[model samples]
Structures are given as structure tokens and as C-alpha cells.
Target: MLASLRQERILAAVRLHGAVRVADLVDELDVSDMTIRRDITELARAGLVRRVHGGAVGPDTGSRPAHEPGFEAKRSWATAEKQAIARLALTLVEPGQAIALSAGTTTHLLAHLVAADAALRPLTVVTNSLAAAEALHAAVTPAGLDVILTGGVRTPSDALVGPVADASLAQLRVDTAFLGVHGLDGDGLTTPNLLEAATDRALLAGAAHVVVLADHTKWGVVGLARIAPLDEVDTLVSDTQLTAEARRALDPLVGRVLLAPPDDPTPEPPLDPGAP
Candidate 1:
């Protein structure tokens, strides 16, 4: 393929996925690694993309405010990776534990898994995600689960943010909190919305442990506001697509680093067989 065509394909991928690894591009374009690297470098120089350690992210992901896509749109970006991460996140939940789930597509996916798990009966779930709250509300068996939704202004991502949500989170404490972030890097977790960053911080404060659920694509992308530094995270559950260099960087800063297995062909089974 011509260099111009290859570059256009690279640009399209970065625009669609928010980030693209050179290795992935090399495979997809059937070109040498050096070829992809040169394309990424050229694109980065032209201000069309932002170069990272092993890949390139969309131009908007630099110091500027990222375009926060709606929850449904974000949901379509990484369905397999999110589902795998959500499945891995479920293992950390114990029966009868109060947990907090911050608003994001991945956390919303986990909420459904949580709702369907009969063994987690008598569980209390606090969240600022309208989608997650709705999922829990629809599937929760009577007297088996309690769902709490914070009151606050909603963001484009369906996250409740502002003083009301922060105050609500401040009053409650949970055994664990699963955070879905827009970006993560040496600087820490980040999001496009400033108010959402504050709300995420509040959620972090209320949890005994913090587990961030992010896919490979978010590894090097930075957003408008930082939520918290890497040291604040207790565990990070990501899909297998996460790079080795990222894992090495996270091992010391994060208490635990977990990579979810590749997606299973069969549907996920229930957490437990016993009824609530």
C-alpha cells in the first residue's frame, strides 16, 4: 500500500479508537514495525495525533479537553474488552459487601453482573451512574440488594457529578469501589469533565480499596482533569491487550495489576447457583 493510504488508515483508526498501537497497526497494514513508527511520528509532528510510548492517541487527548462521548457511544468502542474487564472485576467482590461503582461504561457493565449474582445477596451498592443504578434496580431481587444513587448534575457520560453527589459519597463507606476512567498514564487516572473528576475523587475517598477498570486503549491518553495519581489505586483490572511496559509501570504504583483473559466464546455463567 502507498504511504498516503496507510497514513489515512492510521488516522481513521486513531479517530475511531482514541488510540492505536504501532504493533497493531503493523499487523493490520501488513507493514514493518518501522513503517508504522514513521507514520505515527509524521502524524504526531503534523499535530494530527499525539505520540505516546508505544502508540498514538487522537490529537484531542493532549492538554486540551477531550470530547466526552455519550455513554452509549462510549459503550460501542470497547465492548469485548469492557466485558472481559467486568468479568475479572467480579472476582474481587465478596458476598454481603457494600461497594461503590463510579460512572463509566465498564462499571455499568459490571453493575449488571453484580445484579445477576445471587450469592452477593444483602449487598449494598452506591453509584453515581444512572445506567448502573437502573441495571441494579431492574434485576435486584426483593430484599437481596439495595441500590443507592447520588443526586447531582448529570454529565454527557451519564455520571452524576457536583456537590450533591460528592456529599452523598462522603457520608458512606464501601468495601471496594470500581472506577471506570477515560485515561490513565504516569500522571494517573483522568477524565474530560472537571466535575466528574471531583466526583470520582469523592468515590475514591469513600472506598476502603479502589479498583480501576480501564482497557488498553486508555493507557497513554490524558484527559482534561486528573482524578487521582496511580498511587491511589489499590488494584487495576485491564484487558490482555494492555502492553507489557504499562504492566511494569503499574506493578509498583498499584497494589495489584490484573489482566483479564480473552473473551470467552460462550456466555458468562452466573456467579452462584443458589437463589437469593
Candidate 2:
């Protein structure tokens, strides 16, 4: 392929995936690693992309606000990865424990999983997502589940954030906080909305353990406002697609990194009729 055509293909992949690894690009473009690296360097110098540890990210166009995608829109971005992360996050919760969930598609999926699990009932859930509250409310069945919705101004992403939400979080503490963020870089977890950042900080303060739920796509991206540094995170749950460089960078900063397995669509086993 011509040099210009290969570069264009690289840029297209980066834009489609938000981030692209060198190995993946090599396989996609059927080019040598050195070739890919040279192309990426040229693109970065041209201000069309930003090169990171293992890959390149599309340059911020400054046209749209960072991390401003609507909740519904994000639901389809990484469906399988979000589902896998949510499943892993559920393992961190125990019955009778109080957990706080920050507003985001991953946490919203967690809320749904928590509601579906009959064994993890009789728990308290505090959240700033109206969607999460409704899911939890409807899923209550054999066990009692308390859902607390923080009242505040709603953002375009469907997150409730403001003085009211911050004040509410200040007055309460929980066993864990499962947060969803816009981006995760060497600096820390971040979001584009300033008010949401404040509210997220409050959520962190009110929890004994802070667990961040982010997909691989979020890596290397930085948002407008900083929430907290990577060291502040007690745990980070992400899908296996996360790069090795990300693991190395996060290992020292985060207390633990749990990579959820890839989503497999195998059917569940049948119950034992006589075992019970």
C-alpha cells in the first residue's frame, strides 16, 4: 500500500476505536512494526494523533466537549466489555453491605446485575443515576434492597450532580463506591463535566473502598476536569482488552487491577434436580 493510504487507514482505525495498539495496527494493515511506528510518529507530529506508550489516540478536535456522550449512546460503545466489567464488579459486593454507584453506563450495568442476583439482596445502594435507581427498584423481589437517589441537577449524561448531591454524599458513608469515569491517564481519573467531577469526588470521600469501572477504550484519554489521582483508587475493573502498558502504569498507582474475562456467549448449565 502507498504511504499516504496506510497512514489514512491508521488514522481511521484510531478514530474508530478511540485508541489503537501497535500490534493490532500491524495485523490490520499487514505492515511491519517499524512501518507502523514511523507512520504513527509522522501522524503525531502532524497533530492528527497523539502517540502513547503502546499506541496512538485521535487528536481532540476541540469541536465537542470531552466525555460528553449521552448515557444511551455510551451503552452501545463497548457493550460486551461493560457487561464483563459489571460482572466482575458484582463480585466485590457482599450481601448486607452498603454500596455507592456513580453515574455511568458501566455502573448502570452493575446496578442491573446487582438487581438480578438473588443471592446479593438485602443491600443498600446509593446512587446519583435515576436510571440505576429505577432498575434497582424494579428488581427488588425475594430480598429487600434499599435504593437512595441523590437529588441534584441532571447532566446530559443523565448524572445528577450539584450542591444537593454533594451534600447528600457528605452526610453518608458506604462500604464501596463503584465509579465510572470518562478517561483514565497517568494523571488520574477524569471527566469533562466540572460539577460531575465534584460530585464524583464526594462519592469517593463517602466510601471506604473506591473502585473505578472503565473499559480499555478509556485508557490514555484525558478529560477536562480531574477527579482524583490514580493512587486514590482502591481497585480498577477493566476488560482484558486493556494494554500491557496500561497495566504497568496502573500497577503501582492502584491497589489492585482486576481484568474481566472476555464475554463468552455460552449457555448456562442446567440445575441439578435432586442436589438441593
Candidate 3:
């Protein structure tokens, strides 16, 4: 097939699926991997698609309104950073403690880490993420971990939101709440989904300590709805990739900021004094 035709087909597939893997595209197009990569590269150069690790995503046209990507799409981005943040967040969990995990890819990673750690067993986890609940449920030693899933309408990000989730969270209190957000700025942490924002607020209210788990990418990008201001957060956990300037700017907004270094599996020491 011609290069133009192949590129057109690839663009169509990416538009249809939101994301398309390289191997699948190769098989579907009956083209070599190199050929597909070249076509994708050209398409990306033309601003028709955004090239991701294993696939392409629809172009970010300024004309079109911004929206949150799906759970899988987000899970693939800043993976190392998310894992590092999760590892650090796990250190805060104690045996027999109850924690609430708000719906987000970072929190989902935290849930997986909690399920895998034998030391953190016998803990209760309340969450609005179906993904987090399922990960915990499928753990090898799920007996020790109690997972409470908030039943509600599922959003594109796989977050369970709405009145049902809010009501469920309101009745119970947890020691800490791990929140993942689409965007965090001077104003507050925000999400594109309004209902999910409401549910996240409920999770925040249910916990004594609110920890916001976000990557550097989330900074400066404001979402449609505000969840809570930075002052309300007990700790803000992000990767070391976060600039020093950004940290200085965020210092007064939140109680504490913990930077998780990517190279170090163990949690790094907090930048600020008296940080937890």
C-alpha cells in the first residue's frame, strides 16, 4: 500500500481507539514495524496525532476543548514517577490503619503496592476506584486487606463517582486519604469530571490527613472543576522531576511537599522541615 494511504488508515485507527499500539497497527496494516513507525512519525509531524510510547493518540487541537484521558492512557504516562510516588506513599501506611484512596492512576499504583507488601497487611482501604478494588481483591494474600469500594457511576478514568460514592464515603472516616488529580495549581487540585470532583471532596472529608499524589505534569494545568485547595492537603507527594522553582511556589500552599526520587526505590527525605 502507498505511504499516504497507510498513514490515513493509521490516523483513522488512532481516532477510533484514542490509542493504538504499534504491533496491532503493523498487523492490521500488513506493514513492517519500521514502515508503521515512519508513517506515525510523519503523521505526528503534521500535527495529526501525538506519538506515545507504544502507539499514537489523537492530536491536541487547541480548538477542541480539553478532557481527561482514559485510565489506561494515563497509566502508561510517567509510570516510573507514579511508581516512585507510590513507594513513598506506602511508607506512610501502618498496620491496622484505615486509608482512603481516591480514584486516580497514582492511587491505583498505591493500592497495588499495598496489596503486594506483606508488612502492610491487615489494613482497611476505602476507594472510589474499581481498578484499585480489583487489584486488592486479586492479591495473593487478600485475607488481611479489607477493601471497601464506593459504588457509583463509572467515569472515563474508571473512577466511581456520584451521590452513591459520596454517601458511602461520608459515613466512614479513614486515617489518610491518597488523592490523584488531573491538575494542580495555585488555586487547587482539579479534575475535568465534575461528579468525580464531588466524590474526591467526600474522600478528603472522610480522612484525617489528605495526601495529594500527583506528578509534575499535572502542575499548572487546571481542570474544569476544583476539588480542594493546597492548604487542605496534609502532604503533596510528587516526583523529583518537579522543579525547584515549582516547589518554592507550592511551599506556602500546602503543609508539606515530599519529592520521590526516581532512582531511589526508598522514599527520599522531605525538602521542608517537619514534613511527614
Candidate 4:
């Protein structure tokens, strides 16, 4: 963003002053002396600027950071969207119900929603995500709700996977499984990590109703391993901003796909993922 802004400012100055000095604009732009100089050099390299005395100044286009959210950065964007999905996921729960929750920040938000839930009353929560387990443990354990964390080899994202987690998850039956994925494609849900993929597969086997909780961005991304076929999911909760193609593609796979309304408190239509 800083790079993009500098490019714009250099163009504005060139247009206004017919070639402004980097030194002259430095004080006006409130930018660092080094940053101004670097921007000028970069612009000149891209042919957008003409180097002048002690400065540089032109239509040089440079790359912008891919919109991929850093962990902390993503925690903010679509927060409301994730929160709504989490709320919808919570409504799927009932006291004494046991559900499998997956990894990812959105799932962490779901854990938070479950914790604050007054009406859901109580339930057992199973998870492989360290972050999700941390959040759920804090809420459910204090309230006497059962919380299970699968033990396994820890991955970079702090997700537990491999033999231990898989065995633990396989040993129990859950009422529902709330899964978050890196991507959901025509082929199925996928993950970048092989261990996580195996654990996800286990989650699918041990649950009665499989609910996918994802925001809109996860629609088309294809990852390394297939967790499950799209048709296996009983419910999908996502923001209404899903593309038309995504809506069409997912409609046939899920028993029902739910789009959380961005504004207003209106209740969404209930899906009859009718008794299997």
C-alpha cells in the first residue's frame, strides 16, 4: 500500500510542478526520507520517473501485495461475515450435543460463538485446532461442558494431526461436525496439509451431520488433498456474497446451503437436511 501511494504521489507532483524534487515533496507528504528516496528509485526503474538532482520522479507500475490476508490481517476482514456464520453454526448445536470443529480462524470464531451461547446451553466439542480448542476450553470447561482436544503431531498452524488425533476422533461419534477448509471445489473440500487432510477425513467419518463453515473466499480454491466430496456435506454456512457460479455449483452438492444475510436480524430459512 505504501508503494502504491508513493507512485500516485510522484505522478501528482510531476503533473503539478512539471518535475518536483523528492526532497521538496518529502516534508509535504510526511513520508520518511528513505522511503521517499526508495519510491523515487523504484519508480525510475519502472520508467515512471525521471531521476533529477538528489531525487527521482514517471508511469512506473509496480506489483502490489496479493490480497492474501496475513493471519492477524485476516482476523479483521470478513470478521462480521465469519461471526454470522459462527452464529448460524452455534444454532445447529443443542445442550448435550457433541460436535467436531475444525481449524482456521473462522472456526475459532465459531468456538467463541459457542462459548457465549446462552441458549445452546451445553455440549461436548471435539477439535484438532489448537486455537479452536483453546477458545472452546476456556468457555465450555468452565461451564461444565465437555471439550475434547485430539492429540497428534502439531502442524505449523498449530493444528494437531496424524495418528493420535485421528484415533481420538475416530473413537467417538459426534452429532455434528463444523469444518473449515482452505478451499471447496467441484471435486470436494481440500487442505494444504496432508495430516490435516487425514484428520478432516476422520471428522467426516465420526459425525452424523457434517456442516461446513466457510466465508466466501474459500469457494473456488483447490488445495493438495481432497478431504471429502462436496455431496457429503449436510449443511454449508457462508456469507451471501458468494458468486452466482459458486451458488449453482454448491446447490446440488449440499442437502442445503445457507447464506447468512449481511444486515438485519431476520432469521434464515431452516434446511430440512431431512432425516437420513
Task: Give the top-scoring candidate (TM-score).
Answer: 1
Q: Write the per-residue lDDT of candidate 2 for residues 1-276, one digit (tens) a residue.
A: 988999999899888888777767888889976688779879988989975534677787421444366676566566678888988888899998999999987888888788878788789999998777766877665557888899999886788999999999999999999999988988999887889999999999999999999988778666677999999999999989788888999999999999999854632222122210
RMSD (Å) per prediction: 5.4, 6.8, 9.4, 12.9
List the candidate 1 regions with Cα displacement exceeding 4 Å: 1-5, 8-42, 50-66, 265-276
Compared with the true structure, what per-residue lDDT tens digits does model 3 show for residues 1-276?
999999889988877877677768878989876677678879988989865544666776211214557777677666778889988998889998999998788888788788778787789999889878877775535568788999999887888999999999999999999999987878888887889889999999989999999987667555667899888999999988776766977999898999987776554322212111
Model 1 lDDT at residue 99: 97
Question: Which whole-number lDDT from 0 to 100 does residue 22 have in model 1?
Answer: 71
C-alpha lDDT (0 to 100) for residue 183 of candidate 4? 71
- Order of the predicted models by lDDT, top scorer first: 1, 2, 3, 4
User: Which candidate would rank higher by lDDT, 1 or 4?
Assistant: 1
Tens digits of lDDT, candidate 1, 138-211 = 66666889899999998878899999999999999999999999889887998878999999999999999999
Scored by lDDT, the top model is: 1
Question: Model 4: how far is 249 from its true place, Å?
Answer: 0.9
lDDT for every model?
0.84, 0.82, 0.80, 0.71
Candidate 4 lDDT, 140-225, residue by residue in tens: 65555778899998765557889999999989999999998767868888776778889989988999999998877566555566
TM-score computed on alpha carbons, candidate 1: 0.82
Runs in model 3 with CA error above 4 Å?
1-66, 140-143, 265-276
How many pairs of residues collide in model 2? 0
Q: Candidate 3 or 4, higher lDDT?
A: 3
Which window of 10 residues has the lowest lDDT sum in candidate 2? 267-276
User: Could you estimate the TM-score for every candidate?
Assistant: 0.82, 0.79, 0.73, 0.68
